[model samples]
Target: MNHFLALTRRGAIALAFALTLPLPAVAATKIQHLISPGGIEAWFVQDSTVPLIAMEYAFGGGATQDPPDKPGVGNMVASTIDEGSGDLDSKAFHERLDRRAIELSFSITRDYFRGSLRMLKDNKDEAFDLLHMALTSSHLASSDVERIRSQIMSGLRRDTTNPNALASRKFLELEFANHAYSRPASGTLESVPTITVADMRDYISRVIAKDTLKIAVVGDVDPATLGQLLDKTFGSLPAKAKLTPTPDVVATAPPQRAFVPLDVPQTTITFGAPGVMRHDPKFMAAYIDNHILGGGGLSSRLYHEVREKRGLAYSMFEALLWMDHSSLVVGNTGTRADRAGESIDAIDKEVRKFAQEGPTQQELDEAKSYLKGSQMLQLDTSSKLATAMLQYQLDKLPIDYLERRSGIIDAVTLDDARQMAKRLWGQGLVTVVVGREPQAAAEAARAPGAPPPPKAN
Candidate 1:
């Protein structure tokens, strides 16, 4: 028997082209809702291929809720949640987690507190039960409280001497003066020492209201099962949704350049000011615009002009930090003691130019490409997708926010980016520089006998 095969060049080329075609769409994990009979709302996605399940729970109450005296209380409480919960002491809790191979952690930000858990789908029941207890029935043990408190206070004490840390703290205070956002998320030394257990409990109850609780789960669970799980976990918590009120944004003064003399060899410089909040319509436009200005890594104007071309600093750029009603655009860089001013001047020049003329067509195209590529990459894992979805939910964004996102960038022409830049750039940018030996240099200019130069602006 003989077998023969033959194909013309046209046929072979067609076959190759067919092989190169993209694969069929993997149905994007659809976001579904499961409302507990007790009124808790949860958003979930089902993907059966992975053997893991991840869940995140967030409360509106965050560091901003801390009493003015105990600034870091919220942060401490967030960290202590899983350290001990219900009947399990911290040691016992760790043992249980190790036995089950469960991953659980919590964190607090200026605006919200987050509890996250990841476990094998087969072990999800036990992992979730432990997590639920941690959230609703944390022991708030005195020992753990003091333990975390000590760590935070120690860090705060150290912050005063760390130029980078001091700069950030001072900048927040200056930019958000009179606004809770101005306060550091980690409470000050005074506040941390005074924060009591009662304060922690009250803060959690008030800030972690049902409405404030946004749940995001991604894994092999079905909608019905997820609903049951949510009910079992968070159902008994208070149904009342008492969210943290939005903080006010005071009119901050314009760019004030100040330098703090540190004992360090290098200088850290930071610039920019009040910026657009999460829900602003200009949010997307500003995001793309900043990408071109500095947020786009090596492709950004600040990086291209400041570091690559002029060799002024190793890193430079602007980033948006947003909370409930308060937000800011902060640019930062570190350079030689003498060259720090040069970096700041270069960054300021680029910022002003972008504010006035806007991004060129080429810049806009590059930003769009970089942003779209990032958007696609950020969804690489179920957990990341879930987290992203939860953020949109918390911000009251539409479920299709992801699908509509690329269009926002594409619709942003060069002029739109420029307009955003102009409106958001702060003329009263507070510049903070930390360095050693500059104390005597012409640039130092410290008032005689002042305690110490403040951190970078």
Candidate 2:
């Protein structure tokens, strides 16, 4: 077919639904589980809405899978995987996607290399074909390698002077110590240049295998066909992922004041303590306590104590960050250099208070209500729904997690919340401060930019 006719034919397949019309939302309470004929397992939610299909899958290797000498290899592969594949060269591959309105992309985090693909129902075949090529026979072209490497290098250079990047890196350094978590997810100034195309290929070969893969799918497909697509997209790979086993480690950031001196108008303070594991029975209680303490944004105790009551920092909040190796309750705030000591003192007082008393009954009730109501937003679209399903799989939660999520939250009694509060904040904080030396001894402690992509942490 001529180019225009090919485009016309491709577009015509979904034109009956006009390509832009949204199919009705599928009731998604029940997650359908299936094992492909090839024995590949995936979680599915059959939504024919909008003539669209979205698949999100992850391999257990990410930056952590990078060779010790090559910190950003996985990230570079994520950038180049679609640059060329099999018979299609870089430009040709992208053109096919654009012409058919298919979306396929990859990203790497600290723990997993993840990919997403979306397509009109009429184009699922081509979509899976392109994905298969990406997984199985990506060119990882030398020219593309240099191009992507330069981009990563540029970001690393900028991170050297970027205050937030500097602070985040330092925080991770303190938290993870010698673990892979201590390294930046993308690479450092010295690491990116040394990551060769061969290293990228080695990572791809060893990590993108069935034993380490997790998948979730939404929109316009049935199990049997999805099984075939899964086999086509992933079946040819080696069944076992040859990942270097990551060791178990805890964040070892000690309680004390530390600083990365930088000349800037305001100082940033970061603080954290050990966190409970996701699998721990007390996790839901702790999760709620975290929200009530600092994860609730302006509504949180940290916000009220530091920002509203004292006007110490423009922003302050904490979150429970979970990684394969370590868990932490990390928070950051920015304020005038002179106010740094006061801000730290304020935070310390609040932590002490919360550890002793936990959240008020009214606060717990409100937080639960908001969290329950917000679950709808999590499933508002096919892509997000697929991602949520993927997370459930990653977390090893049961397939009925969505149904049980509310009950889990509701089960956290006043005593549980109080116990969690005491448990989470009862330790000395590991604190890092930047922008200026913290003004006093009592103290301790502690993006956006058109500047560059964020350095991985």
Candidate with top lDDT is 2
lDDT of 2: 0.80
Model 1 lDDT per residue over 1-457, tens place? 0000111111123223422332212126557776766667877777766566767778876777877666777787776777778888989987787676677777777777876776667777888798788878899888888887888788889988888888877777677776777778778777778888898888877776676788888777777777777888887778775654665684365677666778665688877677777788778788877777878888888888888888878677678766666677788888766567677788778777877777888888887887877775667666566677777777788777777778877888777777887787636366777776554533443447644433322
Q: Summarize candidate 2's per-residue lDDT along 1-457 as a digit string, tens digits.
A: 0000001112233433443443335434478998999999998988765667878898997789887777888888888888899999988988888788787888888888888887888889998999999999999888888887887788888887787788889988888877887888788888888888889889998889999899999887888999999999899988999999899787774476578988765778898887876778888888889889898997999898898888778778788877666688888888876677788889988998999988999999999998888886657777778877887787789998988889998998999999888888877678888876544322332222233322111
Error of 2 at 266 (Å): 2.3
Clashing pairs in 2: 23-50, 185-456, 269-446, 432-446, 433-446
Q: Distance from true position, residue 253, model 2, in Å? A: 5.4
Report how far off residue 235 is in candidate 1 (Å): 0.4
Q: Model 2 TM-score?
A: 0.89
Residue 369, candidate 2: how far off, in angstroms?
A: 1.3
Assess the local accuracy of residue 445 in candidate 1 as a C-alpha lDDT between 0 and 100.
38
